[model samples]
Target: MTAAVLSSPGATPPSKCFTIDKEYPKPTLPSQTWVLVKVKAAGLNRAELRGRNGDEPAPPEFGMFVDEFHPDPPKILGEEFVGIVEEAGSETKFTKGDHCTGFIYGGGKAFDGAYAEYVICPSQRCFKLPQTTLSWETLGATTMSMWTAHGSLFQAAQLTKGSTALIHGATSSVGVWATLLAKAQGCTVIATTRQSSKVDKLKSLGADHVLLEENLGDHLKKLAPKGVDCILELVGPDTLQTLALPHLAKHGSVVVTGVLTKQWAMKDFTPALIPPTRKMTFYSLEPGQEEDEGVEKVIEQVIGKVEAGTFKPEQFLDRTFSLEDVGQAHEYMEDSKAVGKVVVTVP
Candidate 1:
C-alpha cells in the first residue's frame, strides 16, 4: 500500500514534508464496530495542508484516540473519502460491498488516512450513499465541504426562509455550497469574494448580490439596511469583528466557520463587539465530535437535492490528482488558484 506521510515539522515549502510510502501497511478492523474501506477517491482540505506544513499546530491529542493505534508522530493526511466497504465487523450493519462516503474523526492526526488504497474507520462515521447517478469523485469531494456548510447554516445559524445571509469567501467549496443551499431555502444571499472575476460566477450560483471583500462595509450596509439575519463568516475574526458584527440584525446569528485569513482568535475580542441581542458562534466539523449530530439527515437532503438536479457537485470540482501527486494537490489548494475543491484519486 502507498500512503502519503507527514513526518517532520518546520519543513520549508511545506510540500517537502509529504513523503509517499510504497510499503505502508494496510489497516485492519480493530473492533466489531469498525469497518475497512477500499478508498476510491479522497478530498483535500486546507486544514490538512496547514497541519502538514506546520502553519497550524496539530491537535494536542492526535494519534491518541484510534481504536487500532499506530505509534507514528507523522500520520496519514486525508480528511474525507468515498470508498467501498471491503470488510465489516460483526457488530456493524454495513455489508462488505456497501458504497460509503464520510469523514474520519481526527483523520491525519489520529490515524492513517484515506490517502492510501485502504482506510479503517469506525462504522458509525461512514454515511452510506444514496442510490444516485453521481460519480465517486463528486461524492468524495462533498463530505468535508458540505458537512461544514450544512452544520454552520442549519445548526449553528438556524437559518430560515426569506431571511438575509452574508457569506464571505464565497468562492470556497463551503462558501459555494452555502450559497446554493441558502438560495434553495429562499434566503436572499449576499456573497463576497476578493477577486472581481468570481463576482459573476457567484451570481450564477444564486447569490442575490456579490461584492469585493475590500472595503465591503458600506456595500453590505446598503444591501441589508436592517442588517442580515445570518452571516457565514469564513474569512476569519478580523472580518467578523470589523465588518460582520456591526451589521448583525437583532437576534441574528453569525457562524464562524473558517480562518482563511490565518488569524484564529480576534485581538481585543470582547462581548461588546457583538450586538447586545445578537449571537456569535464558532462552528467546527471535527471528525468524531459531530458525526452523529444530524449529519446523516443533511447528507440525505444534499443527496436528494443533487439527484433532483438542484445541487451540482460536479460544478465545484476544480481538479483531481493521483495519490502519488498528493503533495501537488496540497500545493494547488494552498495556491488559492482553484475556484473549488481539489481531489485525489486512489489507485
Candidate 2:
C-alpha cells in the first residue's frame, strides 16, 4: 500500500508519496467490534492541512483505547471515509458488503486514513447508506463537513423553526450545506462571502440575503434589526470579535469552527464590562471534545433527510483529483480559490 505523508510542519507540507512498504498490520477485532472497509474514496479537509503543518496537537485520550498510533507523518493523512465493508466482527448487525461511511476516530493523526486502499474502523462510527446515496466520492465528502454543519445548526445552536442564521463563507462545503439545511428547517438563512460575486449565487440556494464580509455589521443592523438567531462562524479569529458578545441576539449562539487566515495575526476588540443580554458560544469539531451524544443521533436524522430531497452533496464538490494529484488539491484548498469541497479518488 502507498499513502501521502506530511514530512514536516510548514505552509503546505508537500504531499510526499510513500509506500505502505509492508503488510498493513491486522486491526484487532474484539468481541462485538470492528469492520474491515475497503476504502473507495477519501475527502480532504483543512484538518489534514493543519496536521501536515503541525498546527494540530497530538492525539487525544481516546487514541489509546482505539489503537490510534502514529509515527512522524502518520501512516496516512485523512479522517472520515466511505467504503464497502469486506468483513465484520462478531455480534455486529452489519454484514459483508455493507456500503457505509463513518468517523475514523483519530484519522490523519494516530493511524492511516481512507487515502489508502483499505481501512479498519469501529462499527459504531459506521452507518448504512440509503439506496439514494451512491458514489464513494459523495460519501467521503459529507461525513465530516456536513455532519458538523448539521450538529452546529440544529444541536449546538438549538436552532428552531422561524429562526435566522448567518453562515459566514456560505459557498464553502460546510457553509453551503448549512445554508441548505437551515433553509430546510424553515429558518431564514443569511450567507456571507468576502467576494461580492458570490452573493447572487448564494441567494439562489435559498439564502434570503448574501452580504459582503466587510459589511456584516451594517447589513445585520439594517436587515436583522432584532439580530440574527444563530451564526455559524467558519472564518475563525478574523470574524470572532465583531461577531461575538453584544452583537448576538438575545440568547443567540455562535458556532466557532475554523480559522482560515494568516497565522500570528492579532485582532483588536474593546471588551464589554458586562455580559450582554445576548449569549455567545464557541465549538470545535475536534474528536473527543464535544459532549453531545445528540450529535450522533442528529447525524442519523440528517442522513434520513439526505435520503429525502433536502440535502444534496452535488452542490459542494468543486472538483475531483486522483491520489497522485493530492498535492495540487491541497494547493487549491490553501489558496482559497476553489469553492466548496475538493475530493480525492483513491483509485
Candidate 3:
C-alpha cells in the first residue's frame, strides 16, 4: 500500500510513500475487523487539516496500516471516504466491487487514512451506498455532516414536524445538512450567515428564512413572535450565548456541534426561561459516544429524503480537490469562506 502520512507535527507530510517502510508497518491482513477499500472519493474535514497544521496531534500508528492511536504526529489524516470494496475481511458484510461510504474509525486519526489509492477500515463503520443514486463525492461528504445534523435534530433534540429551527452558519457543510434535514421533517427552517450575499442561496437550499449572523436574535423574534422550536448551533462561545440559548421557544432545544469561533471562554450562563420553557443539548459526533448510537437510523432516513428530492446533498459541494492537494484542501477549510462541503478526489 502506498499512502500519505503526517511526517511530523507542524511538518508537511512527504507527498507519498510506500506502506512497508520500517516506520510504517504492514496492516493485519485477512482479519475480520477490517476491510480493504479501493478509494474513489475522499472529503476534507477540519480535523484532518488541524492534524496537518499541528493544532491537533497525530498518533504514531498513522502511517502504518494499523498502529496505536495518537491525536497528533504519525497518524493519517482522512475521516470520510467513498469507494469500491477490494476485499472484505471475514465478519464483514461487503463483497468485492460493492460501492460503499464509510468513516475510518480511529484509523485515519490513529493510522493510515484514505488519501491513498487504497485504505483499510473497520467493518462496522462501512455502509453499502445507495445503488445507482449517489455520486462518490456526495457519499464521501455525507456521513459526518449528515450524521451530526440528523443525530442532533431527531435523536438528541427530537425536532418534530412544524417545528421552527434556527441554524447558525447555515451555509457551511453541517449547517446545510441541518437545514435540509429540518425541512424534510416539516420544520420551518431558518439559516444564518455573515455574508449578506448568501441569503438567496440559502433560500434556494430550502431555508424558509435567512438572516445575517448578527441579526439572528431579532430575526427569530419577528419570524416566530414566540421564539424558535430548535437551534442548530455550529459557531462557538461568542454566538452560542446570544443566538442559541436565549432565542429558543418554550420546550425548545438547541444542539451544538462545532466551535467555529476563536474564543474558548464561556461567559456566565444565563439560562433562558421563556413563557414556553427551553432546553439545551450538546452534540459531538465522535464514535463510541452515546450520542452516536442512533446515527445510522437517522442517516438512512436522511439518505431516503435525499433520494426522494425532499432534500439535496449534492448541492452542497462548492469545490473538489485531489489527494495530492491535501494542503490546499485544508487551507480552504481554515479560510472559512466556503459555502458548502469541500471534496477530495482520490484517484
Candidate 4:
C-alpha cells in the first residue's frame, strides 16, 4: 500500500512534508470493534492542513492522540473518507464489502488515516452508506464537513425556524452546509465571504443576504436591525471581535467553528465584549464525543435531506485529485482557490 506520511512537524510546506510510502504495510484489525476499509475517496480538511503545517494546535476530533510535534512513526493525515469494508470484527455490525462513509476520530495522528489504499478504523465510527445514486465523491465529502456544520448550527446554536443566523466563510464546505441547513429549518440566513464571486453561489443556497466586505457591522445592522439571532463564526477571532460580537441580538449566540485566519485565541478578550444577554461559544468535534452526544441522528437527518434532493452535495465539490497528487491538493487549499470541498480519489 502507498500512503502519504508526514514524519515531522513545524510550518513546513506540504510538498516537503508529505512523502509517498510505496511499501506501507496494511493495517490489521486491532480489536473486535475495528474494521479495515479499502479507500475509495477522501476529502482534504483545513484542520489536517494546519496539523501538517504545524501552525495551530490539532483539534481533539482528529484522533491525533500522540504528540503531533514528534511522532515516532510518520502520521497519516486525512479525516473523512468513503470506502468499502475489506474486513470486520465479529462484534461489529459492518461486514465485508459494506460501503461506508464517516469521520475517523484521531485517525491520522492517533492512528492511520485514509490517505492510503486501505485504512483501519473502529466499525462504530463509520456510517453504512444508503443505496443511493449519489457518487462516492459526494458521500465521502459529506461526513466531517457536513457533521461539523450540522453540529454547529442545529446542536450547538440551536437554530430554529424564523431565527436569523449569520455565517462567516460562507463559501467554505461547512459554511455552505450551515447556510443550507439553517435555511431548511426556516431561518433567515445571512452569509459572509471574502470573495465577491461566491455571493451568487451562496444566494442560490438560500442565504437572504451576503456580505463580501471585511467590516460587516454596518451591513448586519441594516439587514437585521436588532441583530442576528445566531452566528456561525468560521473566520476566527478577528471577525468574532470586530463583526460578530457587536451585532448579536439579545440572547443570541455565536458558535466559533473554524480559525481560518490562523488565530485561535482572541487577544485581550474580555467578558464585557459580549452584548448584554448574548452568549458566545466554541464548538469542536471531539473524539468519541459526537457518538456520546447522539450526533449520528443529525447526520442521518442531513443525509436523508441529501437523498431526497433537498440538499445537494455535488455543488460543494470544487475539484478532485488523484491520491498521489495530495501535495497539490493541500497547495490548492492553502491558496484558497477552491470555493468548495477538494477531494482525492484512490485508484
Candidate 5:
C-alpha cells in the first residue's frame, strides 16, 4: 500500500512535512466490526497541517478532535475520504464493493487513515453513499463539509424552509454548502465574504444577496431589515457577537461552525444570552455524542439530496491532485486563497 506519512515537525517548506511510503504495510481489520476501505479520493484538511506544525506530541486524550490529534509522528494523515469497501468484518453491515465515505476515527491515529490506498475503519462510522452521478472527487471533498453544514443548519440552528439565513464567511467549504442547502430548502440566503471577487461566485450558487464583510450592519439593513432567522458564523473571531448578534431576529438561531481566527470561545459569551430561544448551548459533532444520535441520518439526508439533484455539489470542488502529488496539494492548500474544497485522487 502507498501512503503519505508525516515525516517530521514543521519545516521551512510546508510540503516537507510529508514523505511518501510506497511499501507501507496495508492495514487489516482489528475486529469483526471493522471494514477495510480502498480509498478512491480524499481531501487535504487544515487539521492535518496543524498536526504537522505542532511543537511536539499532544496528549493521548487529544485524539478525540479532528484538529488536535497529532502525537509526535502521526499515521497516514487524512480525516475524511470516500472509498469502496474491499473487505468487511463478519458482524458488519457493509459488504465487498460498497461505496462509502466518513470521518476517520482519531483523525488518522486510531487506524491507518484515508491518505493511503487502503484503510481499516469501524463499519458503523461509515456513511454509505448512494449510487449517483456525482464523481469521486466531488464526493470525497463534499462529505465532511456537507455533513457539518447539514448538522449545523438542521440540527443546531433548526433552520426552516422560509427562514432567512445569514452565512458569514460564505466562501468557506462549509459556508458554501450551507448556502446551497439553505437555498435549495427555499430559504433566503444572505452570504458574506471578505473578498469582493467571491461575491459573484456566491450569487451564482443561489445566495439571495451577497455582502462584503465590511459594514455588515449596513448590508443587513437593506437585505434583511427584520433580521435573519439563522446565522451561520464560519469566521468566528467573535463575529457571532460583534457582527451577527445585532442582526439576529428575535428568537433566532446562531451557530458558530468555524474558528478561522484561532479564537475558540467568545470574549463576551454572556451578552449573547437574551431571548429564551437564544439559550446558551454547546453542540457536539462527535459520533453518537448527542442524545438523538441522528448525526449519521443527517449525513445520509444531505448526500441523498445531492443524489437526487437538489443542489449540484460539484460547483464547490476547487481542484484535484494525484496521491503521489499530495505534497503539492498541501502546498496549494497553504497558498491558495480560495475556500473551495481541494481533493486528492488515489489512482
Candidate 6:
C-alpha cells in the first residue's frame, strides 16, 4: 500500500515533511478487535498539523490495553476517512464491503493513518455512512466537524426549537454545521467571523444574523439583548470569558467546542464570570465510537438532514486534492487559506 509518511518535522513550507511511499506495508486487523478499511478518501484536520509539527501528542494511557499504537515518526497522518470495510471482527456489528466513515483516535497524531490506500481502526469507532450523491471528498470531511458540531449543540448545550444560538468562528466547517443544525431545529442562528467576506455566505447557510468579530459583545447586546439560548464558543476563553458568556440567556448553555485562538486554558478564570443559572463547559466526543451508541445517532441525524436537503455538505467543503498532494493539503490548512474543510481523495 502506498502511504504519505511524515519523514521530517517542522520542515520549511511544511509540505516537504511528507514523502509518499509506494511500497509501504499495509495494515492488517487484530483478530477479533479491529476493522480493515479500504480508504476512498481522507480528511485533513488541525490535529494532523500538530502531528506533522512533532507536537508530541500526549500518549493515550489506554493504548496498550486496547492494542493501539502511535509510531514515533515517519508515520501516515490523516484523522477522518470515508471508506469500505474490507474485514471485521466476527463479534462486531460491521462486515465486509460495508460503506463507512469514522474518527481515528490517534490518526496522524499517533500512528499510521488514512493517508494510505488502506488503514485499520477499532471496529467501534467506524459506522455506516448515509447513502448520498455527495462526493467522498465531502463525506470524508464530515465526521470530525459534524460530530463536534452536533454533539456540542444537541448533547452538550441541549439547544431546542425557538431558541437563539450563536456560533463563534462561524466560517469553520464545524461552525457551518452548527448554523444549519440550529436552523433546522427552528432556532434563530447568529454567527460571527473575523472576515466581513464570510458574513453573506454564512447568512445563506441559514444564520439569521452574521456579524464581524470585533465588539461581539456590544453587537450581541443589541441583536439578542435577552441573551442567546446556546453559544457554540469556538474562539476559546479569550472571547468566551470576556465577550460571549455574559450574553448567555438565563440557564443557557455554552459549549466550548474549539480553541481556534490557541488558548486552550485561561488565566484568572472565575465561576463568577458565568451569569446566575448559566452553564459553560468544554466539549469533545469521547475519543472514538462508544458503547453508548450516541455517536452513531449523531452521524445518522446529520446525514439524514443532508439527505433530506435540509443541510448541504457542498456549503462547507472548501476544496479537494489528490492523495499524493496530502502534504500540500496540510499546507493549505496551516496557511489559514481554507474557510472550510480541506479534503484529499484517493482516486
Per-model CA lDDT versus the true structure: 0.79, 0.68, 0.70, 0.79, 0.75, 0.78
- The global Cα lDDT (0 to 1) of model 4 is 0.79
lDDT of candidate 4 at residue 344, scale 0 to 100: 90
By summed lDDT, which 10 consecutive residues of candidate 6 come out lowest? Answer: 57-66
- Runs of candidate 1 with Cα error greater than 4 angstroms are 7-15, 58-73, 285-293
In the range 1-347, model 4's lDDT, one tens digit per residue, is: 88987766543466777778889888999988888999999998877787777654544334434344333323787877998999989988899999887587467656778888899887667777766677778777676788888888877888889999999888888888888878888999999988887788889888899997666777778888888899899888766778888888999999998888777778888898887899898776655575676765666676777888888765677788888888788889888877678999987
Please give, for residues 22-103, the per-residue lDDT of candidate 6 as tens digits.
9999988766778889999897776677778876443441232235444354378787799999889887788898889867
TM-score of each: 0.89, 0.81, 0.80, 0.89, 0.86, 0.90
Better of 5 and 6 by TM-score: 6
- Enumerate clash totals for all models, in the order shown: 2, 0, 10, 4, 0, 1
What is the per-residue lDDT of model 5 for residues 1-347, given as tens digits with 9 covering 90 to 100? 88887776577475687788899998888899888889999976666655657544334323354465545546677878898999999998898999988676465654457788998777657777767667899888688788778778877888899999988877877888888889888899999888887888889899989988788788798787878888888876366656777778888888877765555666766753455555323333665553265655665676677777776655678779998887778777766466678888997
Worst 10 residues of 4 by lDDT: 64-73
Better of 3 and 5 by lDDT: 5
TM-score of 2: 0.81
Ranked candidates (TM-score, high to low) = 6, 1, 4, 5, 2, 3
Task: Pick the winner on lDDT between candidates 1 and 5.
Answer: 1
lDDT digits (tens) for residues 1-347 of candidate 1: 88877766447565677778888888888898989999999988766776676664324324235454443434787777998999999998799999887577466666777888899887767778767677778877677688888789988999999899998888888898888889988999999998887788889888999999777998888877889999999888777777888999999999988778777788988888787999999886555554557777677778787777787765577788988887778778887767668889998
